[model samples]
Target: MADYTPNETGSQLFAEKMWLQGALITAVGYGAVLTLYVLAFYLLLSRLDRWNRQAHAIFLVYITVQFILATLFQASSARFTQLAFINNRDYPGGPGAYELAFFYIPVDMLGNIVYVLSNWFSDALLLWRCAVIYSTCRFPLWVIMGFPAVVMMGSVGSGIMYLLQVSTTSPFLPSSANFTIIDSSISLALNLMLTIMIVGRLVVYRFRLKTNFGLSVSQRDYTSVMAMLVESAGLYAAFSLFFIVPFALGSSVENIAFQALSQVQVIAPFLIIVRVSQGKAWSTSTALEITSASEGLGTLKDKVPMAQIQFACASGDDTSMPNAISHHPSVPNSDTTLTTEVV
Candidate 1:
């Protein structure tokens, strides 16, 4: 019940062919960029010891492998489709076309699986960041995180179902479109909620600090974190929406939108690494003296417990990070009490 025939007018056929080529080109281009980011990540980690480098190295390597697999699958699918169907119009209603309609190509199926897995991993990374930020909250943070976890599970289930359904039928099953739509909707909602929550918590924390110490809190601290959260989630949500619109409408551009979506996933994580590497430097304008013996020293020394700020898995150099007050070039301690100044 579907029209997969491209053997129409010369112009129509040319347009279809060009679209296919464009999708392949775009996917490959993103893969190239992903490779460069991975290379840079490795180079950046060279200074840290193996124990510190393990986490970052593992993350980059996993994503890089997925990118490679996605590229290969896309290329192979395009080649096989052309060789078996588009180029051989003599068999317009041939076995190749029929098989393609009734069943999934291994390459295409694998590519879809990889894309879904990529999204799952990316979402998990985002959730981890949110958890890191709110580790010391008095209220139950895990209880709040539970909502996204449920949504992501549903998304993964829907994605897998959609993949299976497409392979089993032509023009998709009656509810197949619903599965894809649900997946995209869930992804967008999850990312949006996570972004808002993270930013909101940071803003509230800043205000609390301000109230605790007579209005000495720096506005930039909270705002910078908010900006980072927006930048990280904005592109990903936008691309998910773009892909969903075309896909829900069954438009021809859905495939191309998917290619672009994959590219955005790669870009989001790459930006996170770059931002962390840049480091946030806060002003040292405030000084606190613990005792008169230490007065006039201009050295405001406070003991921030190691438990308060935990800068875990940050380029294997967590020990190099200074207190949250000074905003030095070092990584911030993860889940540790970062001793800062009230001055």
Candidate 2:
């Protein structure tokens, strides 16, 4: 909001160092979490060998890219801080204005791009699962996803505009801040909507299963899966809010929270992979069984109740039914994707 000045008070330099310290702490935390993510990815591959390997691989790519973006941010921050402190007096001129301007690092542009891309990638992944869940129920896909999709585009546009403004301006502009604030707000809204819509579909689906099949498996197990999904989304949304609230309110924690936000973007999906692989949530085997059972019920809706259909199809022991199912046909790839939401 003001011109770049090298006349920094001791307190201001200390504050900047403190902000960078918080960012360093967040970076370390993310490093530990990224290790967990890699381990989880391996376990997922081993456990879901029979499932869609391509889809899982793609998801891993998203996480890896997010991690790479964070690493870039950390490197940029280190360079920026070094120029600010260690080389503060090395400029041949009286003082270095670019060095004093913390936001002018070229890496910052790349980092911002990465941050925005990672946020959207995670959001799109969740929305894809939502589409799969609702599609089975004959819900209109475009209608359900249309608004958030538009907002996502708006976020990207805003981010690009903000970067352009930052590149041209001597100091931070209110307009640039507005652009980022809008992007963060939209991102928060997208996450909240995804969490609510997905959790709602899951609860409804679980109820239908219980009503039709009558708790053959423990309700607790089923609930635990739903809870895990909800909690992961909730945690991500919570941090999105944490970053935005301080930022919007002009609170002191904004920088620290923003740094942490980058890592949480990776954490939410990685947690899903870990839970699924551990069988604390739905695994590939469980996902397949549910799909087969649901399809069998759809085909024999008039002849047998859902419970009987599941017994005939899922049990694998009915001699009277072909392959223990009255209507045992190969499930199409589209039909096989019902459990994509759980992960």
Candidate 3:
């Protein structure tokens, strides 16, 4: 409540303000993503069928867990901010120093842990989608996913190390910085590779459709550019670059990007789930269907026949009439008698 300005430089105050701004922006972003999660959850629940119930249930549980982790991270972040700016505002070096010195508090630790967990979930889901999209490719699943799987395991290890390092010391310490950089770089690499794989598969699908079925079919449904972007989780990958680049470069802007990256990660997968619930996402059978349809189009058109039927009614009180049905080759002398009652 007292008007006391700490002896900090203008740049230090500016950096602290950036951190606060990032938190506010993250809160707003979380609200929007939460709305999307609710919509996706409702769609998944309402459209459950015997055929897809098991798959839908698995997704339902996955997204629900993701939502819980994101919610906890956000709550812990808000609590830590409150403690720094209000409860300990009068600490020796001002609120910013208080935040830095107490970064290893329980609430902050929880936020870090959940944030890492959420990232791991999002990355795993993206990798799964990539496998589904590329199911019909000539390469074995292990061949396609092998390197990325190793990198993902490395990411998990680095994330655990990062958490351990931060728990005992300030995140600004050199030891914590090494683990932070390694963890973030691995995550960024994993996301980029998965996004590229997914988008690449969709692009190939589009090309095949265009070549075989014309441009119209290629530009519609799952192969469309927008659909590819959404299904590939491109939004998350792009946002990760925004965060990782700045963080790797030691820029203060990383603070803002870091705050909202987790929410974007969740939003990316939620969008994919929405498409899946709508029956428009790419599936294991999609490539096969496209191939079969392309190969059979001419045969189907040549073999199928069009039929015409004619109905006649008596003008007077007669209730019996004969109907003439005709096929493409013309069925001669084919007629059926009909009886009708007028009410």
Candidate 4:
């Protein structure tokens, strides 16, 4: 590698430095979010009033992928750091940090594909919950199958785009990180709207069913659904400013802002989703207030969660088998849950 004296000015160097700063920030933030998410997920799983084992398992997969992707994207930041340091100074190669920076295109591109697919999968998981939520309503079969089929297409398209870029002569698109923001952006918008639409339909159908049954949709039910939607909206918000400031202006500074914006993109959703579900918010709400009344908070004499209650009454049972079998109901702060078992 031959050294060539560079004529990059101070402003150019500062701009590069900021992108590196964003990368370092991403590395640190990704590690922190992954740690907190794991601890929080386990803590949530321990509590009683929550997503069923099936839904919880789906979430387990979703969050796990999210954590891995964030870590990879952060790892990709090292190249930016090198680029920043070598900007004004003479280094080897035409692009002093090409060896370092070159890998970023695929990293960003693959990460974005997985990122989008995971969103679709997450929403599909939500739809699965909807199938459960509206099972009683007998939500039209078409809607059930149709909504998810459409959503899956977006996830598929995202993957195809990634494969296209990977298999092409260009491993990384020279600009825009080889993951076209335009296609990605349109896909994201379509997804958010799709989720909102599907959820909106669920809400309507839910209320209609309740009305027919001479029962109003409970505040608790509404709260649970709203909480889920909030997660989606929060995710969309993460990418909101990125497109607005950077590509909207179509300037290099905007591109620089775009780079930092990418870090925030991963940071916000990872924190919001992982944190909210950590403590099993559904089961532990104060409004439920059931277990709180128990003297030991429902713990047995030995201070365990009393899996089964034994009752031996005066009923005539010749085999010495008890007349009653009672397992401690998994009521939480409240004596009631949505009763997913029944539905």
Judging by lDDT against the true structure, name the best candidate. 3
Best by TM-score: 3
Alpha-carbon RMSD to native, per candidate: 10.4, 8.8, 7.9, 11.4
lDDT of 4: 0.47
lDDT for 178 (candidate 3): 73
Those runs of model 4 whose alpha carbons end farther than 4 Å from true positions after fitting are: 1-6, 9-18, 44-51, 83-141, 144-148, 166-179, 198-229, 237-241, 253-343
Provide the TM-score for each candidate, comma-separated.
Answer: 0.63, 0.68, 0.84, 0.53
Error of 3 at 303 (Å): 9.0
lDDT per residue (tens digit) for residues 201-284 in model 2: 667657766666544353445445556464336678889888888777765466677777777776776666565556655432
Compose the digit string of candidate 1's lDDT tens values, residues 145-226.
7887887787778778767665655333355264566777788788877777776765664555445432222444324554
Error (Å) of candidate 1 at residue 137 is 2.9
> How close to the true structure is residue 239 of candidate 1, measured as C-alpha lDDT?
75
TM-score of 3: 0.84
* Candidate 1 weakest ten by summed lDDT: 281-290
- Clash count per candidate: 15, 0, 0, 8
Output the TM-score of candidate 1: 0.63
Better of 2 and 4 by TM-score: 2
lDDT by residue (tens digit), candidate 4, 144-170: 557556755755675567556554433
* Ranking of all candidate structures by their lDDT, best first: 3, 2, 1, 4
Give the whole-model CA lDDT for all candidates, comma-separated: 0.56, 0.62, 0.78, 0.47
Residue 216, model 4, lDDT:
30
